[model samples]
Target: MLNLVDSRSVIKIIPYELIMDTVNEHSCHRPKPTVVTISDLLATTNNDDLRFALLYDPPSVVLHQCGGSGCCQSKSETCTHSEHEELFLEIAYLSDPDYVKKTYLLAWNHTACKCAAKNNNRVL
Candidate 1:
């Protein structure tokens, strides 16, 4: 169960099924499945829909992981994506299999070189 807390501390509980409507739970280390339809991918011809699809529920956010190439390996030695777009959904699935199965609201960690154990606001 997820509880959304507002500024006033008003809590709203979101059901698991509602949040996971677009994802499927599978074996760990397997590719995460996307429910985003082909029509949804086609609609991303425009920037707005593309942004929505990439950020909210990207159909391409699966089966990929950073190999410490690109920004995952920086001169600063931190997991910074200043020069490249960080792999978002792939790392999310790697970080938390259980949580990733529940929502597409997954985020990548900018501070951790490997898949992070905790959630962060950073994304591509």
Candidate 2:
């Protein structure tokens, strides 16, 4: 179980890559880039400003798919999932300056735990 501090810190880091992956896998159509509009829509939330800061400009295309369905077919192009992943990771990481420290610490802890687990398994 993650400790309170660790859990809280990790929560600050949104797993945007995972989200994108899930969207890609499940959605019949590509997810829309509505971060700006979403931020506008949720302006009342406590972290609305932060959310907006974290909001990434949805990639123009993913897997050859354009912003909309019919567009990609006409262009005979596909969205680049790898590029989208990179962009999303960049945006997510860039969103919160303050959270950066916490994220790093959390990552270090996770690595340490994984390493320790690996060592224990080897011993066993």
Candidate 3:
């Protein structure tokens, strides 16, 4: 009888403060995610083959197929954006100087894992 009463009492005193804090945390505004435009990607590289491939070829031909060793090694099975300052600066000139998007060859997609064929391509 005493155990049941204590259990009931414990259940009745719900932690309202924790609930409110969680609600507030979820409600707080988050900044928008950065994305690069096709034009921006095109303008960054001087390689004629890459420029032509991006402009003329379909995405299927431009990117490598999924299920590679790299895919298996990655945490999300997707290659995340790398923070390379030199690469960032190279691509930064194509976009707004004040708000430059981070440079990345790999695109983040759960179902699909198609990225540039080689390191030299440098397509985002």
Candidate 4:
């Protein structure tokens, strides 16, 4: 323990209360989370916007093999969407934002989808 004594020289001091009171409400806001669940996607529907988004900003081919829903998919297999659908899925990303696309890319089979592949392409 140290005892306080009057200093010979007067120095400027900032009040602790003043410093603490200056807290901004936004700064105190809850931090954003890093991980998320497909339940967020469950709120959406039969992939209209998802398709539009993919049509707008195509993602890298690196994530092409991703199982979209991140579900029971094999090493190089994807779930049912039709090649056009899959391409749209690969391109469409179930019609959501890139973050949604990323979520879709890494998500599991959120829904019970049929398993198949179609070698078809479409004009987007």
Candidate 5:
């Protein structure tokens, strides 16, 4: 049972399955599986959708650094591309069954440098 407080006057008790079903319905828009890690939840294609999702369900945010690569050079001191790539890599790593079970967050940070390099190429 999950108690959801929509507003001061509106409170509803919902079953876990119903909540998961709603999530699944929303996730069905994407071709990928419904079960997603924190990283995947953060990497939504639509910024508004991502913001809404995060607003409702806050994820465990992780800070990632740009690894001294000129790929993400821009006027801004902070590199948005590098952060996107890191989140993508974290999601990719979490998708792997071998590492997912051990600890998704742990595997995200511990994966080899090659994985990050491979994922970096895919990100814009």
Candidate 6:
């Protein structure tokens, strides 16, 4: 069970079903599942929804974990589209067998890359 705290102690029992009603436990990695829906992926990155993901945290905090690429390996630096996608795909690949069958990994990867590239192409 998760608990929201006033000062580092678990004060209130936050239900395990979700970090909140809007966010599902599976999406938040409660059991650390993979193969999230596109909407789930978007929520994790957006500045607003991400803040409430944890039981305790402020909107100003943005979290990034290490990605294997050595170009600019610091987790502190904001992640690029490729890096984020790679991490997402990796988890889904390892943890969700259905993900490969449903999305057809290679095709999905290609499509996602194209979409990301198109988004990057936006200049205004």
User: What TM-score would each prediction reach against the true structure?
Assistant: 0.18, 0.18, 0.20, 0.18, 0.19, 0.15
Candidate with top lDDT is: 3
Off by over 4 Å in 1: 1-27, 37-115, 120-124
Q: Clash number for every model? A: 0, 7, 0, 12, 0, 0
User: Cα miss at 108, model 2 (Å)?
Assistant: 37
lDDT of 4 by residue, 42-103 (tens): 33546555434533223343211222333323334434332212322223243433354433
- Tell me how far the alpha carbon of residue 14 in candidate 3 is from the true structure, in angstroms, after superposition: 38
Alpha-carbon error at 110 in model 3, in Å? 21
Question: For residues 11-35, what per-residue lDDT tens digits would candidate 3 score against the true structure?
Answer: 3444778666665553312212344
Candidate 6 residue lDDT tens string, 11-44? 7665755455433321211111123243344353
Q: Please list the Cα RMSD from the true structure of every candidate, rounded to 1 decimal place.
A: 17.9, 22.0, 16.0, 19.2, 19.5, 18.3
The lDDT for every candidate, in the order shown, is 0.34, 0.31, 0.34, 0.33, 0.34, 0.28
What tens digits encode model 5's per-residue C-alpha lDDT throughout 73-119?
Answer: 23332222222322332222223323332122221221211113333
Superposed Cα deviation of residue 22, candidate 6 (Å)? 1.9
- Predicted structure with the largest TM-score when compared to the true one: 3
Encode model 1's per-residue lDDT on 13-78: one tens digit a residue. 878796555233321222222233423333534544333333332344332223232232224332
Lowest lDDT sum, 10 consecutive residues, model 3, at: 56-65
Off by over 4 Å in 6: 1-10, 24-124
True-structure lDDT of candidate 1: 0.34
Indicate the residue-level lDDT of 120 in model 5: 34
